[model samples]
Target: MLDGLNLEVPQGQIISLLGPSGCGKSTLLRVVAGLTPAKHGTVSIHGEDVSQARSRLAFVFQEAALLPWRTVWQNVRLPFEIRNQKSRKTIESALKHCLEIVGFQPNDWHKKPSQLSGGMKMRASIARALITDPEILLLDEPFAALDDMLRSRLNDLLLRIVAESQRTMLFVTHNIGEAVYLSQSIAIMSRGRIAELVEVPFTYPRSSELRSAPEFAAFYGRVSEALYRSER
Candidate 1:
């Protein structure tokens, strides 16, 4: 992975780290999450080194990794399980809030992982991450396994959830179009180093109208150029 890297995300924005399969996008994500060590450069949230800051964050892994034995509600409440039982009501409220934010209906909560669709499983994964009211969200291609239709829907769902909650999110994705649609800024990486950080500058609720907007095309072109330069 790159050393001496400096990433600056604004207070409440969605920035996707993107590149080809072998680049350090996911590795960097882990670095930011404290899941991987920062051998050199630092990861900061609100101007503080996150490694020691005890960040209020949630990390959604590449695989949904919803413990097969747990019910959907149980999986959502997993983050709070280790805390004192006296906080169960807080846990339940947070669980309900997170699930409902992701459009999970009450009936679906009682079902086991096996009973849900792939899309539903992914939603449950996201719901688990949100149960703690995280200030930061780190997603590692959480929807890459789904069909395009479902992926698009989840993209929208995630944007809504983040916007409503005002969480800072750093998402890692290989899909360039998804990056354009979901991120306010994008970091292009290659050979374990970031080549560029391009800002879309377009405000959210980013809509389909943006697809034909000139600024969208221009920003897409710039991001494409950065990624291409990285390949060479």
Candidate 2:
């Protein structure tokens, strides 16, 4: 269980929680999403308690977690269906726009989860999360299952979403490289608490070329060192 877990994400900042397996990273994320209650302390999103904050946030899990019976269009429309706060035409328009933002064509919208590739499934998952236009998004290793090339492409998509919409993000990952690519800062967690919070000095709209840069290596080294300490 999370204990004395005091953490915060600034408005519009992307922060990744980096940790070893079972370091409570996922648990911590769940707590932030208000899915798992913290045994101690409060979770405030935008200064509101977790319960009050629920409406302003969206969460994407490690797995796509789409309903097997639903098609892509149906899956992305699920959020709107749950809220039941809009007209059918309005929800359809929002779903279509969200799909476009994630790079899916109208034709692909009819495919079932089984028919889509890993990346496409993730795109749909993200679209579902974005359909509500949440102020903050909690992601739990959404790209971990994909290959490097696919992961890179998804990273680009994620950054584009962040840039265009300026949504605050709290990402959880075991991969240091992924953290380096997507996070403005990395919070290293050990046991049940954060051990260190390291800033990534790189500017946003970062390209794949940054992966090979000396500065990238330098930032990687710093985060790696922090991870090593957390492991100890």
Best by TM-score: 2
Per-residue lDDT tens digits of candidate 1, residues 150-220? 98889989889877888889999998878998998899888887788887777889766676788878877
Per-residue lDDT over 1-98 for candidate 2, one digit per residue giving the tens place of the 0 to 100 score = 55566777888989999999899999998988889877778888767898897988999999999898999999999988888856988898898899
User: Which segments of model 2 are wrong by more than 4 Å?
Assistant: none
Q: In model 1, which residue pairs have backbone atoms overlapping below 3 Å?
A: none
Best by lDDT: 2
Model-by-model lDDT, in order? 0.86, 0.91
What TM-score do all the candidates reach, one by one? 0.93, 0.97
Give me the displacement of residue 110 in model 2, in angstroms.
0.3
Per-residue lDDT, model 1, residue 166, is: 88
Off by over 4 Å in 1: 212-218
Residue 78, candidate 1: how far off, in angstroms? 0.6
lDDT of 1 at 228: 90
